[model samples]
Target: MTVLDDSTAPGLVGPPHSHGPRRDPAPLLPDPEPVRILGTPAAKTFDAELQRDLYRRLVLGRRFNQQATTLTRQGRLAVYPASTGQEACQITAAMVLREVDWLFPSYRDTLAVVARGVRPLDALTLMRGHAHSGYDPYEHRIAPLSTPLATQAPHAVGLAHAARLRAATDPAAAEDLVALALVGDGGTSEGDFHEALNFAGVLGAPVVFLVQNNGYAISVPLASQSAAPSLAHKAVGYGIAGRLVDGNDALAMHSVLSAAVEHARSGRGPVLVEAVTYRLDAHTNADDATRYRSAAEVDAWRARDPLTLLEGHLRAAGLLDDAGVAAAAKAAEVLAGEIRAQFDNPPDPDPDSLFTHVYARPTSQLREQAAELAARLDADADAALAAATDAEDEAR
Candidate 1:
């Protein structure tokens, strides 16, 4: 498939109806299907096709995460963190937007990145330790995945703020621009989180913070991260709208996210959605979760796997059959093989290339260091460069 380019969004064409009021506006149902979906809606509310697509995306994303984790164990990656319970939170939110919307993903939001049209193996490029991976974010309107937990939140706010400036610069250019940010529950502990919310709140920036509350930060549980009972409530302190959703239920996640994105795109300021999810795997490749958690707990959460639940829903909807499922599996397998090949076929960085991009102009310190290091080995610059390479390899 063609990776989306700059021309794909804003002016791109889709079903004309895509721009209209979304879904049904019927009064919300009662407690039996409580609105807190993953509470059920009092009644079925999504279009059949929309429901099916959500199902497919969730299935593909979950399987992708599972396979990537498996690959990590098989030595195909340097590290991997399974977004096992958070696929619904991502796919649902992404399904509602145009390519014009901006996505700021955390390291674990691999699914949303894929849903936004990033290639699968390309998604794994980061884990493969490539200098870069994934297509250009400017074309797709996706910011590079943020490794530091809460940093992306403010950056999303900044992007939305910039969008507003752009829209104001030309009245004819104003359009509905949405900014979506996905961060894990542990990220709430950082000051950047609070600052970002306050910035958006004050400016009424078109931004949304999708909090995948996966219940654990590495070995540290929620209790150790923050004293708040609900991460959504953090928005109240910032004077913004907050919604709590069941992250495990794909349908409910989509519904809530659709509403949130619409609100932001219409310039209604910001929204904070707390997706109550669980981490069914260790934090990353380096950690042994079994040491800090119980096997019983692990088994119990496995039973709540988002993939399995969504698969059951699809089968019930008569949308997924053996052939369809088989096709998706085959496609993912082929993509995985390609990813493995790319990782195996390595590229060597030029010894001098790093210095070329180190600055727009080489700083005095770097120039002196390069010159001194070059002279120490009797002008065989390769010797100094080789020594540096050895040091990096040793540190690793």
Candidate 2:
């Protein structure tokens, strides 16, 4: 029996075939070693102003993550998936995008959301158990901090594809539009991840997928989650560019993400970036990380902390002096205070607000449910008033 090859049977090989030369996947593959900027000669050429800005944001992001975690302990926040050690990736992801571009962030990407100009308290509303989404997504061009894993990937692709279609008719907006979707390592296992990437590749959507491979997916380690060479390598199968960067290295992440964003904006299609970072904190305030990871492992990542890595580079370069360090610390303190004050007396969302955005035109069932809820609330108010009046009469 003779076996058929792709040369004779193009149909058997699927969509990778075209009339011209077959695209080489080798050039598109990520580096064997994760790209590094700090502790290297490349650090010298990096823009001093951008370096300093990244440093400030990383400092603020670390403080923000800590503050959110503390709120969870204080019962102020319902839950928080703190991106403590992954601040580099968070800050860089937000910094790379243009104002017109859209950002689809994961639940753990609160830092990214705030970095993109979303108010600190506003970003926390969904996690605070108050409303569906805290701020208007259209106004800020940020999709809701997605609670469901990998779901935002498809949404980002759809938006990017739509924008590309719009740009085809209007050349003025062509270069200004792109979309970014962030996902965690654990989310990569979801079927949505595959679907989104497949569609993005086929449609040539102007989107970037940033996968922060922060060692674990809650309790599951990366080893158990994937047997692939690296998360970035998965992009090769989709026929797009892939990148790997030191996620803890702020400058490296900023450089890589900036390139990817520009490529997407220029209509080059999607790029998948896998940032190798570590999550120092537990899954959340409620998790016991000690049960899953050893203290030695956590200490190792802490030693190579994103803040200290950038701070060390800045200090050695003389771009950041004693006064500069003090100023950054003071700014972070101010942010922490602001977060505390806002969350201390968080605004109570109206009970009826839930039904307001349920649909463009609410269905009959939703209308009935809303009426029932309103009636129940009125009855409770009447009962409380009657009880208070009876007590007053008895006292008289």
What overall lDDT goes with each candidate model? 0.77, 0.92
Candidate 2 lDDT by residue in tens digits, 142-202: 9999989999999999999988787789887764678999999999999999899999988
TM-score of each candidate structure, all chains considered together: 0.80, 0.93
Q: After superposition, how far is residue 228 of candidate 2 from its true place, in Å?
A: 0.8
Global local distance difference test of model 2? 0.92
In candidate 2 the C-alpha lDDT for residue 136 amounts to 91
lDDT of 1 by residue, 1-396 (tens): 234433567455445555544533122111222135422453145566766676667767767787788778787777887787778887876777787899998888877887888876677667766545555888878888789988999999998888899889976877678899988889999889999999998889999999998888888889888897588878877767777877887777887888888888887769888888788778887888888899998888787777777667667657778887788777767665665666665664344444555799888887877776556656577778889999999999
Model 1 steric clash pairs = 36-39, 38-246
Candidate 2: clashing pairs of residues: none
Best by TM-score: 2
What's model 2's TM-score? 0.93
When summed lDDT is taken over every stretch of 10 residues in candidate 2, the lowest stretch is: 1-10
